[model samples]
Target: MVLQSNVRPGLTQGLIALMAAACGFAVANVYLNQTLLVDIAGTFGAAEAEAGIVTTLTQVGYALGNLLIVPLGDIFERRRLILALLGVVSLSLVSAALSGSLTWLIVSNFCLGLTTVIPQIIVPLAAGMADERNRGKVLGTVAIGLVCGILGARLVSGLVDSLWGWRSMYWISFGCMLLLALLIRLRFPVSKGTASLPYRRLLLSLGPLFMKEDVLRRSCLSQGMIFGSFSVFFTTIGFLLQAPPYSYSSAVVGLVGLVGIGGAIATPIIGRVIDRKGASFANKMCMLAALISFLIAVTAGHWLPALILAAFLLTVGTQANQVACQANIFSLSASARSRLNGLYMVCTFLGGALGSYLGVWAWTRWHWTGVCICGMVMIAAGMSAALGTKNGGNSHKR
Candidate 1:
């Protein structure tokens, strides 16, 4: 087995934990608006439809961050970039917590989304730090932290919103972001091997990546589809659970997201499998899990147990497939891994923006069935995209 040298010598596992936590906290900014949409709408005297725009704009901000901000990972020192973005996120959260109108809230959410690229930078950094023999494990560990952060955000946001008010969640996250930024600065070693490309070349090189690399293209598409489907579920679930048949509280609806932890836990295991046996087998199984989850969800009305199980399977499958896609991309490009990640995540977040809008539209039009159809079709589209690439092979640049 081949081993990759640690990017920095004398880096302790404790520092790695701190780095991953920073990424986790940073990424959690993206979803903080989702669980609180209703409360936010009422607070701002906006209609539910207008409040939905909060989610859309935040996703749009994330998409923009990926396209415009994350590419800088190749051109700048990663630690400085991470800390800078953390500062942006911290400030944005503070502003969001203080917003007096829907418009101001939306603007702040967009800023938060645009600046929250720390996870994207950190994930590739972690992969590069470990050798092929343990890359999957290292990625898995970081991914676990990220997954928990993503899920935990909803839980903490809900609990805090319940006690202090929804706005306080942002204030709390603001504090977390500040502490994380300081800890990362003091603890994590600087990445000595940061890509030294000029910004012009870094931006222009993405053109060939799209035109030439089938792996980059397909992986981006697959993640987009999976994330799109996932977005639809969470976006519209609030509407469903709050409607006539269920009428669950916001906290309970948030608890429902806890089911997604199954996927968080499954990510590293799937990473291990992708490490041993190529993604061929795992990809297909993940797709199957998504399809099955959709099938069960379509039939589950008033059957709370069935609906929760379906949600679990759907999240687990999507997250596992996402890890596989990232692992494959990392395997393909040693030098441009961060840019590759930036490209894929940008596309995925774009898809999520589209999905969240579509889910709300579908729910408004045809209710839960509409959202379910959106999920199934998107997942199917993702599966077809992955199938278009060679299953047992790797692509190389000339």
Candidate 2:
């Protein structure tokens, strides 16, 4: 079946920005707990390593949701699916805010992840609607929203936690999700399903999709590794900052997310690069930026400036690499975009879950040095995947 957009002949700037904002707001729920990990640990009288499980479990749930729920986008009306997910996530945030114990919070957060698949669904929707000429740029615009939500979650959560408490952050997120759901209902066009396959067939197709598409495979492997490294740095950085020489507060540590705004600002330009120079070229450059980020992060234990610089580079790398990979896979099959996205993101967040675990584990045993080693190894593995793929001449043709 041929997919169609009912909105208008071309996507307007206002609508694009709205979609971007929606993506940012939806994805922020997943990372809100990162900056508050230290405070959460103190609240529950649990070790920091134990507190880190909140982040790990959230990613694991996200991966599972991507695998199981995101594929439904292709079989159901997208606007309804997205709104239903938003409602579920809002309830999860409330559950998180009211948690009386760490175990309760962990379970709430996992539920939060399970319902937070809205952004993944929206991304493919936007990509499918865009013309090939502007697909990369549009994807980048949406990516900017996703990146900001990710980085901004830390900043907002930290500030809210410092001002009120960690629980207050969840309350704020719940409000934000409700507001976003209202906006989506009012503003988003009704987009119908593109495929006629049964739910079971949709689920069954994902494995063959992964096995059949080379671009999908490479994009998944490389982006998954980079996302793992991205998770490693973020999951443990709060712990590092709250202790040791700097001894900064959660709010102060969250300022590091502001540094990442530089990366977000650069995403559209990277999107254009992917459009002109191809995903292969952009992928290589992004991997190099990540490599440098971790190298600088090794010195972050003693120097504040190094940590800030590393954060900026890593954000640029991960965000840009995502735009590249999405641009590559969305080009493969219009009818299968959501399924392709689901498969790609399942791998990406699984990598993130592993990185979250390793980040805490490394921090517990080897300290900052160990964390840096783990991040570098993940980046190296990603680089190997990108280097191994034969360069596609242009991403639009992929």
Candidate 3:
């Protein structure tokens, strides 16, 4: 097995910045629709429950793409593979732009999720491109872009849709994807993959690897639950904000994401603690913080200030938990980074998809409080798994 810092070539700042932009743009697709969910439902004359499928299916597609497309990074030339995926992503974005019906929009969004797996590919590429000295810095810079993309997409989409129309915003996204694809195809360096395994064998190895790696399993469980809890809130926050207690516009709903930037800023601080102490310590603290976030969010239905506080805590805790967990899991195998990432993302997003579906369901039945309870339950379940599992186990052999 090759170590990432040893075999993979380090990257330049210019390349890193480009990669950061690409990562943000790709990830923003899934999240851009969160604040726009209300307007979308209104457009199609659908219920909140039905419109929630947009987020749910998009997340499910992301999980599917992670499982299927991301593993190819280990099997193919990274640059060519990325460009190919970007081509398909561009097509999906264009399809989203042209969508006339809710079903069409939903289908287009799912495809967007599938092809937008580019960021996952890019992350391992960034890791491959960084040496020990700048590894964290490179990754952190790119990560901030991704965080901003996730939060900022809402504001852009909301403002665009409010000013122009929903279709126009998607058209803009479509053009951006096309432009990025062309630029990357021209500029990205060619890269050879390190893995020697055949396609079928590589795909088959994941289950056993999951069984064998305690760190991977524990991290997946902890991250899955935490991310699920996080998704539950995002999927339903629109519902809460659009109703009578607040009656905020979709544009106003999107502004709430600005609040999450406060959380994104805490990432470096969290990383420092992880370096000094351990990922386990950081995750435990995040779990407690998440619990508090959910508790605070219970009042968000009535109080906007409480809602802002809740969003900050949830984003901060979720970010730390994700970073800490990935650090633990990725430490297990450098050679298998792509496949390990595929598995990790699949687990995480499966939890996210489940949470999206159940969150809307809970909101339908019991409103905002139900969503808060779900978040707390996920935290409890994740903590239980973390406590029950052993740490520092052997890495898997393929």
After superposition, candidate 1 runs with Cα above 4 Å error: 1-12, 395-398
**lDDT per model vs. reference:** 0.80, 0.89, 0.79
Compare the candidates by TM-score and give the number of the best one: 2
- Candidate 2: which stretches are off by over 4 Å? 1-10, 393-398
Top candidate on lDDT is 2
List the candidates' TM-scores in order: 0.94, 0.96, 0.92
lDDT, candidate 2, 293-371, per-residue tens:
9999996546888888999999999999999888888888889889999999999999999999999999999989999
lDDT of model 2, residue 48: 91
Which 10-residue window of candidate 2 scores lowest in summed lDDT? 1-10
Per-residue lDDT over 271-362 for candidate 3, one digit per residue giving the tens place of the 0 to 100 score: 55655566677778888888899999886547999998898888888877776666566667778778887888888888899899989999
Query: In lDDT terms, how accurate is model 2?
Result: 0.89
**Which wins on lDDT, candidate 1 or candidate 2?**
2
Error of 3 at 276 (Å): 2.2
